[model samples]
Target: MTPFMFVTDLDHTLVGDDAALTQLNQILTQHRHEYGTKIVYATGRSPVLYKELQIEKNLIAPDALVVSVGTEIYLDGKNTADSSWAEILSTGWHREQVLSITEQFSELELQPDSEQRPFKVSFFLKQEVAASVIPQIELMLEKYKLNVKLIYSSGVDLDIVPRSSDKGQAMQFLRQKWKFAAERTVVCGDSGNDIALFAVGNERGIIVGNARQELLEWHNQYPANHRYLAQNFCAGGILEGLKYFGFIK
Candidate 1:
């Protein structure tokens, strides 16, 4: 196997199937040891939530963790947060103002305090009403002149982060800082929030079979030869993609 950066979203993208996840963990861990492969997990989960999942699922320890919808980053299991990323996001972010504006909507339910970060404000908006409510929120933010981006996923989670902050942007930061070749990188995901992961780079991409409608729509709208839509679901999908991209045998 060639050395590559393996970046993935958790939840349904990498964790839905226990057996598949275990197999993937073993493969990634061995590659990290032998080939200097870098592994990253970018997810909407907070550090605390991620830790919980780590214990439950026995996930491989990634070289870097992008959490809180890419609002926060931690390196090598360090307790310290990455202040550099925070500084970059601080330029256009106004968390309090975001909360203040979003507070007006009764349809939006604030997520737990842990899930909220200095650069991210999250909520739960039902899928049925998200279409109408998101635009309204967008109008309010535009009127207020706030520079934030809204990301909705899992048919429920709504995360508002700085305009420049997201899983893809974060991954780009890591890739550039580490000098990873675009061709030697792979990103795996299964939802709308993961769309940006596929959009910004020439890195090989894997869209799992059991993807959400939003992601499927995006894949159909902009098909790329660099990306493979796998026939398997979850971690199995990732394994299939690694083969399809020739990252492994």
Candidate 2:
């Protein structure tokens, strides 16, 4: 098997319930010599979150990391390259609107007013809390900026990725940085947040049946995110995706 690299979302793609390293990691390990597969996490998570996972030994350490929604990139767990569109985040109404909403109503006392590089944003919230807050956030966001996109995942945690800061964009950047051809890259994920990813055609697209409707819609149009799986979530979906992609079999 030829070496193929996978740039995946960490929270849902590679990390499962109990924060267990997805069983997929063991599978990935098995194929390392045969398929030459290397994984890099392209996550909305911050470097601090990555370090915490490392300390807990919960995440499968990746060959590379695309952290903070692609604002930062690391190779060999060391900073190799980075780009900051802080000017965009700072003056942009999206950041300010988010700050305003969260400041006024969010139950979480997270850093919200920060208008600088490395915002260290929070990606999700507990379900009950989210239910109470998202409506207000949406109302405010609608009035302020439509450029930003919000993705709500199962944990009631919300991920605010610029319609631009998608895991897809990060994966594409990583693919070129490592000199890998687009045809050799594969992305697997479930959730509306993952829609932007299928926009890139480098590799196969695998979506689990449990994915959101909006995501399913994107797949229908592109026939790219059309790759679908039966597994539920976490390790189940990832394993199914790998098998469907013939990454394993």
Best by TM-score: 1
| Error at 25, model 1, angstroms | 1.3
Q: List candidate 2 segments past 4 Å from native.
A: 17-23, 33-35, 54-57, 79-164, 212-214, 217-222
- Cα error, candidate 2, residue 85 (Å): 8.9
Every model's TM-score: 0.97, 0.67
Q: What C-alpha lDDT do the candidate models reach, one value each?
A: 0.92, 0.62
Predicted candidate 1 versus true structure: per-residue lDDT over 3-88, tens digit per residue: 89999999899999899988988888888999999999999899999999999998888999999888898999997779999899
Candidate 2 residue-wise lDDT, 1-249, digit = tens: 677787667665565544324466677776765666778877655676767765665566687787765556677766545543333343343555565656665465453332132433454467777776777777766777655655565554465545555567667766776777766677766665566566756466667545666667667776644466546676677777767776677
- Supply the TM-score for candidate 1: 0.97
Q: Check candidate 2 and list the clashing pairs.
A: 124-157, 125-157
